[model samples]
Target: MRIAAITRDRPPHTKHTAEVVNANTVVSISFFAAFCPVSSRRFPAIGFERHSDEAKNKGNDFVAWNSLISSFASIGNASGAKNAFDAMPGWTIVSWNALLDAYARKGQQLRRMESLLDAMPEWNVVSWTIMLKAFTKEGQIDSAVAVFDSMQERSLISWTIFLQAYAARSGHLAQARNVFERMPQHDAVSCNVMLVAFAQAADPASAKRVFDSMRQWTDVSWISLLAAFARNGNLEGAKNTFDTSPFRNLLLSTAMLQAFAQSGHIDQAQAFFESMPEWDLVAWNTLLTAFAQAGDLYSALPVFRKMPVKDIVSWTSLLRACSRDPAAASIVFHSMPQRDIVAWTSILEIYSQAGELGAARSTFDRMPELDTICWTAMIFACSRSSAGEQALELYALMQMEGWNPNGVTCLNVLAACAHLGLVDRCQGFLGSMILDHGLSPGIEHISCAIDLLGRMGRLEQAEELLRAMPFSPDAAAIRALLSSSRTHRDVDRARRRARSSCSSLATIPLLSNAML
Candidate 1:
């Protein structure tokens, strides 16, 4: 049957012309059916399955098989993509690339990608680029560089990806610039990456230099530069860029609105928002954020009511604005049509900050999903309440639930351990942060550890830690050690710490006098 005839009965909107001229080729039908909007959404995998079966019965059409794999991959059905790959009569380079792309998009499957790359019959630029992206996504920038270096030929995309990998890291802008300079070519994307890097570094001068050097300007080019100025609090620069732009789209207009809102020009922001020819959800949210940041709920509420459609950000922004009044925030929280983790966490933080532990715990319990920040917030609340035992219990429960504690969570956990004088537990948590989570203990963590050691009469170990910690002992760390020395009556150690504190410019003269 002709491909057109097969799809002629499909809805007019779903009908697409196929380029394949052969009447017997199943590949065309497979591509059309797999992507046909109506069938893809309504039947999903079923349509692919039917096409695959027909292709198998008619002949072993690798193109049909590859099409099915790609369709499955696009929807993030890695398992389905793999199944189609396994069923393929013959695998082509495209087949391997399709499967690799599926796994890359699935994320956190680096090991699988490695094994697949090793097993591939050969590597192409596409395959290598996919692997480069997978490493970058996983924050393995060094590995991504190694992959880039190993490639005999690098495409502009590969170079851009390599540039972005460096740019994304704080304090690596020099390296990103080096990569950009060395690139065989520069695209709008690579330039924007540098633009954002400088913007985030609060260097609009450098960002503008890069912007001026661009040979061709895209909308993103304009927005990135405008945003750079906005971020640096140069509202005048942002306005000039907006006014001179060849076109004014919603996104560009929203960026200007954000510049005004962020710079505390609320009056300008409101006026600019009103003047916009049309507004997207983002522009509305930006205005709400302005009032929320300024603590002007009186103004924020009206904007919230005026929005045509409310997204999670819209609700969260308003919820944040009502933070001072937990009762009002709670009312808004309950009224939200949908509550995401951010909203739930915000409400929990409000209650926790208000010293309503019962309400905080209740809100935490009611949350359908909990991310690292949410878990950290609740643990912090318990820690601050001096419920050290309860905080430790929650920390244990957080681990049992398979949530890995981040640095902030570790800080709270260490503080609780210190309050309870659990030296052994404190040491273990510190060690695990390094070994399991791969997090180096910040000075705050070390201070808590020192404090715990001192409270438990391990003054010598506390002193040793103070001297041995990679960070120069801060005021808190020294005070923790000195306080413990006084408690333990280690006069010599106290004097040493006092002198050391003065020399380090973290002087605690009152403590030093008390110690003497």
Candidate 2:
């Protein structure tokens, strides 16, 4: 149960990235069974691998093979793990479990995991639980149920894993709740999973109800409810939830840090960050992002300079801090020891916002590489400078370079077309956005498209487009349609436009006159 040391000296186990205590716990029990009293000094692993060779663990004639097997399994190299396991002169139940963990790391390798389980000389409670977890991971509820029925025995760990699987499957809420109710043993993890499921489904109140009902809570329970409240924009509720936690772990602290930072409580965020006993790169980068997002350059710059480590995130945060000040941003950018695609885009956005097309263009051209966001920034950069033609050129070049345009990029392209009064080109871009890029036309893109249609005296088509939009016509879309209706002075269309604009702006008392 004391797995903290097992995963120590290695990166924390992120469920998405690696297995947790389970792999190492099993390894500790079984793998070391082969060789005891082995020295822990490691030798280099053979072949191309990022991992150092595990501890040579030589015990004279009997070498301990478990550490090597565990290391291979942790990295999800089933082949390497198996090779090590097979080369072993003997096997233990823990060794079999470690192999299963290795195979289960990748959910797609489920069939192989099943086969490996079948080949096990004998099975233990851990072995069966491992198999249950494998099915649970793949979200195969019915198959997991089949295994459960056939299970001669089960543990709380297996029971909890099964309960958690229901939450992972979106439509199985009732089933998940039912499983939670049926549990003879009540544990915080199983309870927290249900709470997190409710939170993700945008039912923070339900999460709260669950939290209140818990006889005893874990750190995860408090953190889940705190995050849920914050995510739902109940900042006051989140703070209250944070206050009630019996203890604070890193995950809880980071969650509170983010909640405070995002809600614009910079001082609270700083206080929380300073209060933490330890910090990770994410924690540092998060604080930097908080200041950058608030445009607190004075605060952000010092933090940037003071950070003991700086990665792409740190650099990008610094650039974002000065995004509104092109010259300052460029100064920070040029002084960077390194520049990646994000760093390029951050400075590009600054120039684009300032409408310094030349500077933005230079930044774009010099980028070592460009992804969709970078290319989109270039198009938006040109859109601001009355250089619709140039923006179109960038859009074309973006496609030529094989970067698929996103919805935001399509919005920029449509804006360029509107500025140039290229109704035909706007139509072409809209077609490409929907048919080629598969982007849904949002309000911004719709507004630009409508304006382009109107400029060509195609008032009827513009009105039709607005009416056909999937979303309700926003103020911009409404305005574009109204502008076109008046330009062509089609009486019927103008009257209809006036009525709709009035309805859309009904709450804004003075805007009715402007719309009419």
Q: Which candidate has the top score in TM-score?
A: 2
Please state the error at residue 252 of candidate 2 in Å.
Answer: 3.0
lDDT of each: 0.80, 0.74
| TM-score versus the correct structure, for each prediction | 0.67, 0.70
- Give the per-residue lDDT of model 2 (tens digit) for 346-394: 8988899899999889888888888999988889988888899999988
**Regions of candidate 1 where Cα sits further than 4 Å from its true position:** 1-151, 161-178, 198-209, 229-249, 260-278, 293-296, 450-516
Model 1 collision count: 0
- Return the top candidate by lDDT: 1
RMSD of each: 9.9, 9.6
Worst 10-residue stretch by lDDT in candidate 1? 1-10
